[model samples]
Target: MKPKILDRAIVGASLLGILISTYALNVEMAIQAKPEYKAFCDIAEYLSCSKVLSSEFAKGFGLLPNESALKIPNCIYGIIFYCLCIFLSSFDKLNVIRALFGLALCTIPMCLYLAYLLAFVLHDFCVVCVSTYIINGVLTFLIYKKMKVLSAKKTC
Candidate 1:
C-alpha cells in the first residue's frame, strides 16, 4: 500500500480509538457520579462494560501501586495515545513513522494484559476495551506498512 494511504488509514483508526476511549471515559465518570448508572455498552451479565470499567484494574492499567501519583484512568491513557498517533500520522518523515510504529507496537503488551484481566480476573467482556484493542492493532499494522513503503522508496 502507498504511504499516504496507510497514513490516512492510521488516522482513521486513531479517530475511532479516540471516540471509543472518550465514550469509555464518560462512562467511567458517570459511574463515579452515580454508582447505579447503566452504560449503553453494558449489554448483558457476561458482557458488561460497566463491570469491567468499574474494576480496580481499569485504573492505572492495574499496574501501579494504590498510593502512586499517576493513577489516572486507563481510558484517559487511551485517549492520549490515540491523539498522539493522530499527530504522528500527519508527519511524512521516516523517523516520525518509525516512532509512530514503535509507539503502536508498544500497546500490544498492555492490550494482552488487559485482555487477560478481562477474561480471567474480571470475567466480563467490555465492548469499549475490545474495540480499542482492535483499533490499536489496526493502527500498528497501518503504520508499519507506511514505514515499509517509505523505506522502500529510499532504497530504490
Candidate 2:
C-alpha cells in the first residue's frame, strides 16, 4: 500500500487501540477499587490490579509507581497515540517514519513491561492484557516499517 494510506490506517488503529486499552485499564482500576464492572472485572481477574497495580513490583526497576511514573507508562502513551492520530489525520500529516518512530518510542517500554509480567508475575494472562500486548506489538511493527522506509528515502 502507499505509505500515506498505510500510515493513516496505522494511526487510526493505534488510536482505537489506545481508547480500548484505556477503557480496559479503567475497568481494571474499577476492579481494584470496587466491584462495579462485574463482567469487565471478571474477565480481568487474572490481571488482578490488586497484585499488579498496587504491589512493590508494579514500581519496576527500583522506581516507585507514582502518578507521573505510572502516567508515563500507560496514560501518556495513550494520549500521545491519540494526538499523533489527530495530527496525522489532519491536513499537515506527519511523515510515516516520524509517526512510526513516535509509535515505537511510546510502545517499546510497554512491550518490555508486558513481557516482564508474562515471564515473572502473572502465570496466566487476562484477555484484555493479551489484547494490549498484541496491539502494542503491532504498533511497534507498523512504526518500524514506516521509519525504515522514511530513513531509506532520506539516504537516497
* Model 2 pairs in collision: none
What lDDT is reached at residue 40 by model 1?
99
Poorly placed runs, candidate 1 (over 4 Å): none
My TM-score estimates for the predictions, one after another, are: 0.97, 0.63
Tens-place lDDT per residue, model 1, 15-120, is: 8898999999999999999999999998999999998888999899988999998998998999999999989988888999899889989999999999999999
Candidate 2 lDDT over residue span 80-139, tens digit each: 665665455443223745754675566667667766865576654555545556766776
After superposition, which runs of candidate 2 have C-alpha atoms over 4 Å from their true positions?
Answer: 32-37, 44-62, 65-76, 85-106, 151-156
Clashing pairs in 1: none
In order, what lDDT does every prediction score?
A: 0.90, 0.56
Worst 10 residues of 1 by lDDT: 2-11
Clashes in predicted model 1: 0
